[model samples]
Target: MTPLGRRLLILFTAVLLLAGLGTGVVLHAAARADRADQPQSGGPAVSTGKLTLGQKGRLAFVNGAAGPHRTAVASVPSTDPRGGRTASDLKCARFYAATGTGVCLQSVTGVLKQSNRALLLDRNLRTLRTFPLAGTPSRARVSPSGRFVAWTVFVSGESYSSAFFSTRTSILDTRTMRLTPSLESFSVVLDGKPYHASDINFWGVTFAKDDDTFYATLNTANRTYLIRGSLSRHTVTTLIQNVECPSLSPDGTRVAFKKRVLSGATLWHEYVLDLTTLHETALAERHSVDDQAAWLDDHTVAYALPANGKVGSSDLWSVPADGKGAPRLLIAGASSPAPS
Candidate 1:
């Protein structure tokens, strides 16, 4: 072979090798991101099982790691608690404002297929009653008046996710002690017409002041919808698109939700939808929020932001609902923030 040909062959081989190494780096980074998006399993349990109060203007949320088993509910003081006693086996909890009542959902086993239960709790996070349920727990909420409670669980073979993780959302009327097994039974209307799809799944329920009306997210036909539902009619009507995890504001005038925007890298931006005018104002939060936001007051919204993309590393953050202020960190190593 000519000397020039031999040199060109060596140069071409080197180029190929460099290209292969670059591809490998990209693939490795992609794998790491996927793993980070998954929920973390088996962390060290909470050492202190104490349940604090929001009465001192503090926030109450699922301690997530506060019991003997580590999957428990906990509270953070707006100020230090004067005296308190801890509770064990919390699993999960959500408190309503000023009602001294909340709902706690717990899975007996960490397995997704195992049975779960919802417990009615008093102000101090002590269980008053328990109801058995199916599926792995996900979200829990209580009405503003504490007259109603709702919970969502992931059910296999029913969800429309590419991973097949569907949801079974249920509601309980504490006043009548009536539990609706699933929201799937409710009728849905889309585009001014009746829409029925077996793949329909609902989650992220936030109730209104009257306790008779609520807002939730419904995923169907490979799209997400913000739905306005009524407890009296047992039906849901689609209001807008690309919205999920609806959280009603404290004043009942607005709803804070995640708006899915697909441009370059699909992003979920926090947006507040004015109920009266049906308008949306995107907040200043730039990170992807996979949580149903909690209202801190009439003007502020708090939610869990997963740190480094890992679900277990969620941190609590607050932002102005009107899309004016910058995001501020409220608590570290905490999630599912519920203000008192």
Candidate 2:
């Protein structure tokens, strides 16, 4: 199909799903009903014991084995392990835990092009409320104070290449229950000049300690730029180039992101950029990491790597933020690691 035709097809699919006109819902409901007897994997839904609230060294991640239809939010002691615990009630594609609260993007009905929901829950994994979302769920994160929530979804676009996809990122204010439809709605300035481009797209938002300031990847003119933005002002200004999926450190002094390195144009090497000095430090993880890393603490960064080079199975690994220590396994069969 032509690129225009491909885009139209994708748009039509989204329109049908959003308009509540897809049969996928009925199929999904039946599948869920059938699996009611068999619980989703990752462990039992037992009490987490003194770990109800996020701990400084504990980590919360999504279990990879738990299929897209129903997944579990698993938790384990970061530096120490008492045992394993899973929140069976929390069936989400992506999740982020912070400050005794969490935000999750869950597929409510279907497997692939299904209707999705954004859930806000307390430390115990109890849902406070949910917002219906559009597009395929990708990533979800909460601010340091758990006051702001942000998410990204992949949507169909006008690209003839089969790999072409567009991203839709949204933010929600938990205090007021206000939602921004898309980050694309905000104005962006490049190189101190007011800039507007039709092809502008954004993803992978990492918030600062202030909760109002954030850094995200902005794609325009066929180049990726790291743009710093403010929720209060709704404006993004370019900070640097070629950085994707920036993860701000706990102290807000540095950002870890994926930088392309190989000639194949697909390999992404992880690197940390010091926000104050603008100096970049290459991490020790030699393998191509395609995840937005989470800070295990002020000194460590944790991310997911495919198990045995297989995409279906992923294991969480941690490396020193200062590039001093070797990567070590933190958790097995996990993706989307969020350190508390």
TM-score of each: 0.76, 0.80
Lowest summed-lDDT stretch of 10 residues in model 1?
A: 79-88
TM-score of 2: 0.80
lDDT of 2 at 250: 88
Task: List model 2 lDDT by residue over 117-235, tens digit each.
Answer: 88888888788888887776777778889889899877765221224668889998889989998999898999899998887878889898897999999988778889999999999
Give the Å error, residue 101, model 1: 1.5
Model 2 regions lying over 4 Å from their true place? 1-51, 55-57, 65-70, 81-83, 108-113, 157-163, 309-311
Q: Once superposed on the true structure, which residue ranges of model 1 sit more than 4 Å away at CA?
A: 1-56, 64-71, 79-89, 93-98, 110-113, 157-163, 263-266, 308-311
- Candidate 1: deviation at residue 21, Å? 42
Tens digit of per-residue lDDT, candidate 1, span 1-340: 8999999999999999999999999999988877654434553223455554346566665544322333345565544321232324565633333377777776665556555788888777777789886776677888878888898877765333334668989998887888898999999999889999888999989999888999999988778899999999999999988888899888888999987777333467899999888899999899887778988889988888775554555667889888997998776556666677
At residue 100, what lDDT does model 2 achieve? 84
Candidate 1 residue pairs in backbone clash: 50-86, 58-78, 63-73, 63-74, 159-166
